[model samples]
Target: MAFITKTHQEEALAALQDLVAIPSVLDESQAKPGQPFGPECLRALEHTLALCESLGLRTFKDPEGYYGYAEVGQGEELFGILCHLDVVPAVGQTGWKTEPFTPVVTDETIIGRGTQDDKGPTIAALYGVKALLDAKVTFNQRVRFIFGTDEENLWRCINRYNEKEEMITAGFVPDSKFPLTFAEKGLLQVYFEGPGSDQLALQAGGSLNVVPDHAEYQGSEAAAVASELKKLGYDFQQQGEGIAVAGKSVHSKLAPQGVNAISRLAEALVNTGEFANPILEIVGNVIKEDATGESLVGLFTDEVSGSMTLNVANITITPESSRVGLDIRYPVTLEKETLVKALGEVCAEYGVTYREHDYIAPLYVPLDSELIVTLLGTYRELTGDMTEPFVNGGATFARAMNNCVAFGAMFVDTPDYLHQANEQWPLASLYQVMEIYAETIYRICCK
Candidate 1:
């Protein structure tokens, strides 16, 4: 029997549209007292909480707009459904069939910035719980849909929520691909800075977790760099002694797949010999095009989690100093301390100072655990997919809670458009996810 019906799908789509209409990108400039992330992000949280309230679910907005959650049922043990309301900036991205903030619903898919990345799955899960409520199903445990506002940035939203709310007993996050993620790699964001030259000024890139799509540098050798860029068959142009290079952008987890604009510009700078000495050497020699960390501090790989990846997400050069930001994902089997020490050694050798920003330790749930068994069994039964649960390079809200794992929202064969232009969520896939969440909620909470 179908767990989510036609009415549920309609309601979910309507809710998704309302949430997607707001440009909830984090802007620290607009941040204030109650709105910690930004005004738009806070607005998205308020709209979602209101929607839940309209649906007869008890909702709670964090005192300081860090996070919010909607609750159903009554029990001491809480089963959480974690999702995020904040999205990455889409203002500069091109090739969108519709405006990035405008939700476009066609016969097949929902097209927008936050559609597939998170907001779509959020609505689906909400409707899934709504189905159970409308059916008057009793539950042995409570279900709470927790929404975060700073997922694309530092995850301060969830951090504050954890400090304030009671710990969840067990749960799943619909933020990654199915058959379910049993393990996730550790994440490290590091900054490297050193004294530089005044003759050159360089800045480019966006979020530290995304492959830089564009980079520009202005220096004494801008003309030479432009010539080299043309010779190398790169898309570049000169503007007032500055040359800009355009490259494709993809999630840092899949860094190997995208052409990094920051690295490309760095290579040209090295060739032109206009940049500072060791800074150019570090960029040209150590952090070239390879996504693997082999060139930086060597590589770590294991059968369970796969190889480590590194992305040179951003770079800035000024008269006083030059700064480079890196986003690294290491295998679950490796220790964070070991990786950090190795990286520090390499940076010190190049006369650059290394500073750590944010670190998320690896999350590994035993494949044989009851939580994995239940979620994996439900996924296989619903989709008839024989693929086993696997490790992921991407971290999720699953890591923030105890005895939790990332489940569904994306299927095994679904094309990944998260954090890229033309982000989309198939209507049929969302409906299917709603049904799965409905059934999973019943089995985990009601039974």
Candidate 2:
């Protein structure tokens, strides 16, 4: 019993290598100018669209600066395979054996920024669509492979696409943990402003969506917080009264709870009374981490998507106010107003203000749906592995469609370096994923 694909693996691998060579880190500086994101990310998108155009496929770039689409076949029902090209910032000094952006192939793994996070998968999806087109598979649905640009920082790309285009039927996104992802917890990235006296200097945590790997504090009184962190076995350095604490970086924040460095640092600051701001007192009184905040929906625990998760991404202090930007993934059943009420209470009590800068509702696709059955069956047929669809705490472009689920690309048994240093995907796995996607596209479109 062997599963071999007629799809061109060499072409897929070559495309993946070419995509890996591009450094598509979102440029905050260029976000306002011509490219909006940056030259590299825009190049990544253009490269994808050009590849699609080479296949004689019709391409469309939505009005919003974040999305591009390639359409093939002509039919009433629309099927989509959603993916992104943008990647998080990767630095060379981040303890990587090879350059973070420049991908290097080991025995089985392809190491680079978007290797596993997105770029590799995006290429795989493109290859899959190419296979279907080359095979002359005709069906009643128009298949669109959407490559988004802002999946890392924001979802402006998909938002703009959905606003102008028709809704998709059922499709899969090759992001996040695989087999199948049935549920994605609701997400809210916010800025929590509070009072600060400039007595404590705090720094660490790279982004809201990712767990912070490095954080530090400055000040003599910070010793208490540093000492406590040291007691907790955190890799911390004390320099001129400032302390740097290091923790593990993980995606799907709710799945990996204790690895959040920023949360741990904030806890230490609160416990040591290092934050003289009244907001600190209020947060300590009301939002008691996993305890008092249980009243919130996802703040509790659920059998499906687990409990509420929080990652305090960044903290800023000024003469007028102090703030902590937080990324929270709550449960879908939880009411936004209820959580806002609780936060508002704490903010009012502490003379602080709360604002939700980003709100993406949890995406829940029924496991029993035809789309799920078809996708799951196709995966099992290819891999001969019986696995159930699961949930993810990380958001994906699948949520942009009316009926779509993240199918493959990332797996449960593999090491997923999504949004981390030296992100990579096994080359063998990449080939298999391309074949799976090819079959999935053909079956959905030609059946």
lDDT of 2: 0.72
Q: Which numbered prediction scores highest in lDDT against the true structure? A: 1
Predicted structure 1, TM vs. truth? 0.73
The CA lDDT of each predicted structure is: 0.86, 0.72
Error of 1 at 423 (Å): 4.6
* TM-scores for all predictions: 0.73, 0.74
Query: Which tens-of-lDDT digit does each residue in 255-357 have in candidate 1?
Result: 8889899888888777776555566567765777878888888878877888998888988777778888889988888999899899889888988899999
RMSD of each: 5.5, 5.6
219-338 per-residue lDDT for model 2 (tens digits): 677769777776656566776767766667765364245455555565667778556766444333333334213532224556776677766566655556677766777765676677
Query: How many pairs of residues collide in each model?
Result: 0, 4
Model 1, residue 272: displacement in angstroms?
Answer: 17
